[model samples]
Target chain A: MEESLDSYVDKGLVKTYLFTAVIWLCIATTVGFLLSVKFWWPAFLSNIPYLAFPRLQMVHVNGVAFAWLFTAFFGVSYYYVPRLTRQKLFWVKGAWLLYFLWNFIVVAAVIEFLLGNNKGLPYAEIPIWINYIVVVAVVIYAINIFGTIFTRQENQLYVSLWYLMAAIVWSALNYIIGNWIPYYWATGNEGAMLNGFYFHNVVGMMVTPLGLAIAYYVLPIGTDRPIYSHKLSLIGFFALAFIYPFTGAHHYIYSPIPVWVQTIAIVTSVLLIIPVWVVITNFFGTMKGKWTKLTESIPVKFVILGSVFYLLTCFQGPMQSLRSMQKIIHFTDWVVGHAHMALYGAFSLFIFAAIYLMWPIISGKEMDKKLGNWHFWLGFVGFSIMAMVLWAAGLIQGILWIAQVPFLNTVWDIQPYWVIRTVAGAMMVLSFFVLLYNMWKTNKEAASMD
Target chain B: MKRSGNVILIAGFGFFLLGFVVVGLIPWLQPKQSTHTIVNLKGKPEPVNEITGAAAKGRLVYIHEGCWVCHSQFVRPVSGEKQYYGPVAQAGTYNYQLPMLMGKRRIGPDLSDEGGKHTNDWQFAHLYDPNSISPGTIMQPYPWLFHGSSAKPTKRAVELVAYLQTLGTDVAEGTGYKSYWQYKAAQVSAVSTVVSNTPQAVREGMKIYNANCQGCHGIKGGGNGPAAASLKPAPWNFTSGKWMSKYGTTDKDIYNRIAQGVPHTSMPEWATTLKPNQIWEVLYYIKTFSQKKTA
Candidate 1:
């Protein structure tokens, strides 16, 4: 069994995943800073084509969403899946090929977008050829994950395993439906509706589920306690499976989509409150009387804070989906704030926690708690400041626009808000450095343990 | 150990299930009804033809491009709007719209009555290269709409024009169609006449001014319109000497300034927004501003 578990932990795969995560984290954070500066001082990079606001925005979003988060996800999954299942990966070669292919697709997509060959949908702006590459990579991922599960020695699946399996399967299915090839490239004129469907589902099915799966696995393990309620976990999982697909329309509340579609979206979004709150309450309740433990364990701190962000983001998401609320917030920086809170605050933090918790076991070493603490504090403080500033900017912009105060007057009013966002974004950049430092230190310690 | 973990897991799953029902399933099953009513204010009942019409097809293009994110088609009933945009939009104006474009943002102005507001040449120029006709416009030029060629009008431009010309006018009242034809005829007449003995300085200034200022100031220096309307601080009526006085009175002052530009206002610097001789022509035109008469 010891030999088997040892075989399950591949140092090379873990290193590859970690290196990608660190590299992409730096790239994404830098681009994020550049995007914020562009907003604050448009003249700074106004002459450059690739650095223009629109192109920079695409780079920033894709870097964070695809490169940073997915890299982290790959790293964590590579480390934990084998340890949790008590078996070696189905195919190490297959997984390594997936890593290379995934990166290749991301790099090509970024270049295509910079060259102005975009499909023009938010989040789906990558060119069609690049999208096909992503589809190929996803298929490879699905096959590898399923093969690993089928070959596992464990008979009774753990809740973590269930979540991991469900996330992969569901994401694979949703991606195909969301990015329906015929609709996206064929009828370019009506592609917006199809793109909107695909774009929101990417958030709902891909980002949300994957993040939650990692959180569920890491939180219980890091706390040295079993989950508070298995019933609640199942509820959250099934509820997400049933409801997330329809909620994509919420993004179109004031849009030109049919009224019935928006109605479906608003109701689903509001109802999402139940699943989101349930998950929050259950996770926190399990941590009941164990607050001190959280403080002691850096991984616990990251996981708990991530869960808190999840609660905050989902609640804000539902509120923003309401037609009346959308009237005040749609197409404004408010949605940008919401995306950051959901994707970065909740998802990325959870992924980070999963990495920290799993790294010691996978690499056969103990991480320096001091470095972990530094990383956690930086990320927590940085994310909090960034989220707040973005939310404030979005809200102010939304209210002023709706008030019809006057076009030129509104632009003048929001100049200070944009400046504040840039300042807040600086904190996030600092946090990324701290994260890299901690991860690098931990890696060295793990090597020493070997 | 296995038994305990299993029990704990089961309990966790159960709580999640309950939460799902309360939050996810319940919301999905519930009926969502909205109280707000959208009014289409262009003064005509939406024709069945408009519902299944070429305008609807153009609207699909609008959606595909995410145009609604920046440009609202609806004009709200507000004091600033009433004063600036002619009339507030009504619910009837949207009766023909299948999916209404009452967009939520004011990145650009409300475009409810953009029809009959400008000449076809002006619209074509703006669409082909927004910076070519209106220098400070933040709106991305729709080069694709002009077939991705060198800023020439295309069939898509014509179709888009047809859609814009339908905005804000009551076609049922017959005035919308009449005004559209009248505007088209005037554009033809204006294009035919070449001003005789026009100084090179004046000609350059006119080109600069038209490319950078025409959207808001009107092609003829009259403060008429652009497709965007929801400007909170309304666009300046350039025809007024009072407005011109806000800049400066002297011809040289106006020339140097127009060649440069006021900071922070939509007025971009001609060094960037226009060429040097173009700036001089724009300045020459501004010198023609008279306090005694409106354009």
Candidate 2:
């Protein structure tokens, strides 16, 4: 069994997935920077079809979510499943094939976006063909991971495995129901309401579950302590699955979507805080005597920081769902800021922790401490500044609109904040490259020692 | 209860399916209904004011350009949107559209009732180069609309213009097409060829033109202002006697076009931008350029 597991742990595939993720991080964050600049200078690089505001924005979002976040999640899943199951992957060859296929779909979909063959949805903008490909990939992950679990060397299932299972099933269903059904099933308000559910599910169901799974697995390991309460972790998992899916309609709060549906969305969104609190308490409680580990371990610092941002994102999400608050911030830069806080500051930080924790074990080499610190501080500070500026911009724009100020004047007023965002985005991009360099150098040192 | 991976997967799928059924499936399966109407080309009643022909093609162009990304088509009851954009758009307002482009952001004003807010001429010019009309507009110049030069619109430009003019055609609030053409015709045929030519009127006209028209139509009425480079049909040259004679450039004609901008041109309706007295004064100033001989 040990020999079989040794053969199954393919560092080459793991390294490839991480490398692809970092490449996307660099490329997509630069696109994000360019987009922020476009807010201030609408015509800059706009002559190119792909460089235009809307298309470029889509590329940045899709690329970051699929190429950067999901790819890292995929790599971590491969590393994680074996450790939890105490067995090799059910099909290593299939995992390798899925990796290439996933990258191809992401690249092809991005090209399609530039060529204007988009499906016209916000995040599910990938064409129908590419959407099908993603469905196939999700199914493969389910079978492979579940197959390993069935033949596990250990009988006990960890809390992280439950989230992993739920994430996989929900992700597949979310993609199909959100992307496919909306095309033919509905139109007008009904379609918008359905699409809204699909939109939030992409983040709430997929990213949130996978991110929490990583935290549940890594937080204990990083701080060298067992979780405080197994029951709390279980409750957090089920609560999230129940509440997160119903909260999508809150996006269309003031729209023509039936008032009841909007109210349900608001209530479910508030209920989401229960899972958030449970999970946060479990993480912080695990650190009761090991708070000093946060200063000692880079992975612990990232995991702890992610928990704080996660708390902020959940709190802010419920507040924004309120009717009075949605009136002001729904369509403004505040939503943009909130999205970044959740996706980048919270989940991306968790993904970085996974990378840091797993890299040494996989490569058998330690990361450069100085470069890792640079990566953490730069990313944390840059994202915080960008989020704050965008939130402030959103509030100002909302108030000005309510006061009946000319729209163009509001656009001009937000120019300075956008400039600040561009600089912050650049720093975030720089941090990603710093991370890539650290990983590469560590790998090189390992190879030389061998 | 002890749960295995398969059991967890099954439970998760079931939970997600419940939300999917409640929030997604039920709403989608329900019948669509709307009260909006329009007369078809065959003069029959249509359920919805269906967009067809050039207008249909224009909708494709709008999506291809991703115009819906920035401009929402609906207006909410809250946010004082009715005051800004015309009416609070019902769900039915967008029923005719297949993948409704009820966009998310309001980077530009809501285009729900944008069909006839400005004349066709202003729409064309705004499409070509937005700054040519609304100074400081952040909209990019669609030089592609003219296939390069603004001398005349291409076939696609004509189709795009047709689409913009039909955004709110179901409501009586759309640019009252029949009356606008009639009013435009009368203004041209019933105008006096000569201006008042009083020095005071001409001087006041110069000031009005300087403040407004000179940005596009140039100082000295030469149609060569700094912004003229980006304008289509390049602002009308008041100095060209031949062109003036062909179009019957008279005080009443100038006043009419000024008060109600020429359809499909860059010239905006000056009625709100300038007072009636200032429009009359600008007419005298335009006449002086025609009265001059090239030294």
Candidate 3:
């Protein structure tokens, strides 16, 4: 079969990370579902302070960004690096050691947040000490991956490796800027400005590069063609690195942050459409004569589905950064919908495709195709319904607010939409459960065979 | 040499540093706005805006409880927020905070100028059980912030409330409307022009009563509304004539109580929610519950 794919790979380590990622995804989505439900049923778990909305919110955001996506990226990176480099993974033992140590830190950070010992900033809510442990873990991971690249038998670095290296560097820097900088340096609105930078970077640096890595690698292979344009890929990668950092303050537009800085953020945000479309164009170009693969391959369908949402969300992001649009939607559920669309709708879908591709290779067993399709439609339809309701509800709320009506009335008016949001959230959660079932069954069969 | 890897690595890192300086570093270098001193509801200046004492402890409790998550602190100039929340907050108003807690969502109302909007008694009751006063409120009952089964303040709750009370007072606003309302009510409070005890007048009073007072004071003036348990000293039930007279409940006294709110009870000030005539009408409706010849 082609060239034996796994002689140098640590399949067991990849399997462990993938399974861990799915469990954390389940936990995080459940937290998000409860958050939506709590809008109407505030007292459902009111007796427990840890289950309070804010505490649970801390659990939700961090669980997705750190616990879920971070681990999934680890799984994919472990699986992809050796294949791309044509080398055995460097410091395989160290990767396993970091796994348990890193997960322990994540769990401890979550518990500490629930215990009311939190940093109280967006995308950086974990307490400061936990931040140090996280950075050290990343350092070890970087060294291991970099070592593999250094000792590679393949002289030509793949497109995925370019992204892999950038993501490692960007994430380490972005993480420090978000969690650590404020403790020593900034205050008041300055801190908030830094937060806007950190907020976008977590997704921009953490998810975007890694997700596109998987997408770029998987798309051409699934389509049985080379990428559409090498020049386009190069343009997209460098433009993204250059533009993403300047765009975060768009989230905090109209705040106490300086107007010029906000403008800079807005301009850079709109400029992002270039790189975003370039990446999409390259992927679509790769998919040029392989339309039939949509029916033949589940991973191709998911990657394509994720690309559409990625385009919509990235476009929506820049439009929102425009101050006029923000005057209506800022602080509303519209932003919430936009955020969920990016992470859940776009990036998670890309990662799901990777997991689908990787599970069989790593485990030597296949997940049920019917269940995979079920997961796809449920996740796609459920998230679309949820995002639309949040966006519409947010628009209505924003209109009511601008009309100068009572604030409580807006909260009341949106209760019905929240019901829809909760139900759609339930569907998405169920989709993940279907995935969990398929992966678990594969694990069982793989174990029995061994 | 892997020239491509070095280009991506060095340039990617270069972009990261570029962003760090422009977005992160430059903003902190801007001269910070001044620290704002709070003026209490009595129109007295508080000890400079360092936020020490109970209020300072309350600030920590605010963050700890994640109150800042739902309750935003700054008010914007657009969208009638100034009309609604009293003032558009400047950056200096939050100068006391190391990193300001200008939260994103306003699931609750903005607390920009929230000081002295309601009394400590109302704040205590609302914090223990928000639905007690605003039947449709989305706020979760923070009973843990209180004592066992009562609205009595634990140190944290008291500090939290203290911090809340100081919210928008930093900018020398509020009490303008309160004093104006008080003066207007005092002018015509002696006579019951709007509270005629007629069939139509009583019906009008019933409407206002149902809208506002009926939640806490009960449908039959029995102080046994659905939310009555969480309040200390409880809401008043006027079914018994004795309790009505205990407060020297003349027409003027009744108007003053409605406008200023009662102490040690769940009754919030109607200065903002009701007009003077509406309060007088609701007063006449409640008087009918008095089992006395003079009701």
Q: Give lDDT tens digits, candidate 2, residues A1-450.
A: 545554556777787888788888888888888888777777788666666677777789999999999999988888778877777888888888889889999899888878767777667778899988998888888888888878888688999889988898888888888787667756667778878998899899999999998999999889887899999998898899888888898888877667778898999999999999999999999999999999999999999999999999999999999999977876788989999999988899998998898787677799998999999999999999999999999999888777655465567678899899988888898999999999999989998999
Look at candidate 2 and tell me the lDDT of residue B133: 52
Reference contact recovery of candidate 3: 0.50
Local distance difference test, candidate 1 = 0.63
Ranked candidates, highest lDDT first: 3, 2, 1
Off by over 4 Å in 2: A1-8, B29-47, B151-155, B173-295
For the predicted complex of model 2, DockQ is 0.29
Assess every candidate by TM-score: 0.71, 0.85, 0.88
TM-score of 1: 0.71
For residues B1-295, could you state the per-residue lDDT of candidate 1 as single tens digits?
2454344435434543443334233433322221123322333344322433666565655544455556666443432344334355543454445344555455556676666555555566566655444444455566666755433556656767767766765532433434322322222211111232257766655655554566666666666546224222344565667765776665555655554434333342333223344445565675564432544
Greater DockQ among 1 and 3 belongs to: 3
Which should have the higher DockQ, number 1 or number 2?
2
lDDT of 1 by residue, A65-183 (tens): 88988877777777767877776788888889989998897788677656545544556666666767777887787677667766777776666666666566555555554445423
Deviating ranges (above 4 Å) for candidate 3: B32-48, B173-215, B219-295
Q: In model 1, what lDDT does residue B246 have?
A: 72
Any runs in candidate 1 off by more than 4 Å, and if so which?
A1-6, A181-194, A363-371, A444-450, B1-295
